[model samples]
Target: MPPTIEMTTTWERTCEVADLEPGWGEVALLGTHQVALVRITDEEVYAVTHHDPHTGAPVMARGIVGSRGDRPTIASPLHKEVYDLGTGECFTDPGLALRTYRTRIVGGMIEVELDR
Candidate 1:
């Protein structure tokens, strides 16, 4: 048997939970990657890639926040391509998908797990 390797998660502090308005998207720069931070409720926050896969534009911060059933979603501001905030699944187009990041709140600050 080979030696097991443990993966370490690096969480980057992005912003305060109060900084994000519910039902709106805000852009945060995590190193070289731009992330779209969305606040669905006071206790619920989500992070996704700001780059729109279909248009190749960094405009997801301006996307519309909505929901498909009980799953929270965000729609591209340019072409209206909807994506699942938690899974990064594109509902409108199966070929394209947005990237999602894990988010947590500590001391009222929002931290995102960088995709590595």
Candidate 2:
């Protein structure tokens, strides 16, 4: 039998919580990936890929922040594709999906867990 090895995930600190405005998305560079950081409230923040899956353009930071029912969503500025901020599920297109990252706040700073 082979020994089991455990993997640990590292969280990268992006910015201060005060740096993001509510209902707006900001772009943060994580290594070679561009992430769109959106703050829904003082304690709620979401991190998603800045690349638009439908258009293959990096314009997700300019997306409009809104809500569908109780779910927080962002609509692409280019094609108006709505995506769930928490799950990365696209509402406009069944074949398209957005990439989402895990986010957390610690000591007044925003941290994101990027999949490398």
Candidate 3:
């Protein structure tokens, strides 16, 4: 398990922490947007837009988790384009990107800063 990262900003509850399994990903609807949620570890969770930039398909939740050097990544299932989970930068194509969201666990629930 990784150390807890305390986020200072206010967070909106999205789902229960247990709703996502470690080492895997899930999709959650935030307002009208679809957010991809990943439980990378027992104490680490990441959220990003579920849309795959290359195909504009909501397929990121189905992406395979991986790493590029030290950076954690997820490859789009549709095109296999790799994207950094932390920055949403596409490693396969510099011109492409995904919207990253700040996520934190609070009271055993998953929360995210949707505006970020």
Candidate 4:
């Protein structure tokens, strides 16, 4: 079975390091904030708000994972807006941008530092 991550104070422990799959995104709820976690590689992971800035729909988690040059990105499923996984910069529309949170792998577990 896929391992799960439970909420904790300060840094929220996300899914197990193995729970994150390469080339995919997963959504985790910490209180009311929805976080989209993307696994680019075994050593890399990124977290962003699941809310699509264009349509304001919480569907970024369902967005397609890809990259522009060397910049990892997630394409909004609702409007096809692409956002930078590292900086949350919207490439499709520079005017609209998403929020990015800090992430790390600790002790074989994925942890996200909630952006407050």
lDDT per model, in order?
0.94, 0.95, 0.87, 0.88
- Please give the lDDT score for candidate 3: 0.87
Kindly report which residue pairs in candidate 4 clash with one another: none
Candidate 4's C-alpha runs over 4 A off are 1-9
For residues 23-65, write the lDDT of model 4, one tens digit per residue. 8889999877899999988789999998999988889989999
Q: Whose TM-score is greatest here?
A: 2
**Looking at model 1, which ten-residue stretch has the lowest summed lDDT?**
4-13
RMSD of each: 2.5, 2.3, 8.5, 8.8
Q: Which sequence of candidate numbers ranks them by TM-score, best first?
A: 2, 1, 4, 3
Q: What is the number of backbone collisions in each predicted candidate, taken in the order shown?
A: 0, 0, 0, 0
lDDT of 2: 0.95
Per-residue alpha-carbon lDDT of candidate 2 for residues 1-116, written as tens digits (9 for 90 to 100): 99988776779999999999999999999888899999999899999999999988999999999999999999999999999999999998988899999999999999999765
Using Cα atoms with residue i matched to residue i, what is each candidate's TM-score against the true structure? 0.91, 0.92, 0.86, 0.88
lDDT of 4 at 11: 84
List the pairs of residues colliding in candidate 3. Answer: none
For model 3, how does the per-residue alpha-carbon lDDT over 16-71 read when each residue is reduced to its tens digit? 88788876789988777799998887678889999999888999999999888988
lDDT of 1 at 106: 93
Name the candidate, 3 or 4, with the larger TM-score value. 4
Candidate order, lDDT descending: 2, 1, 4, 3
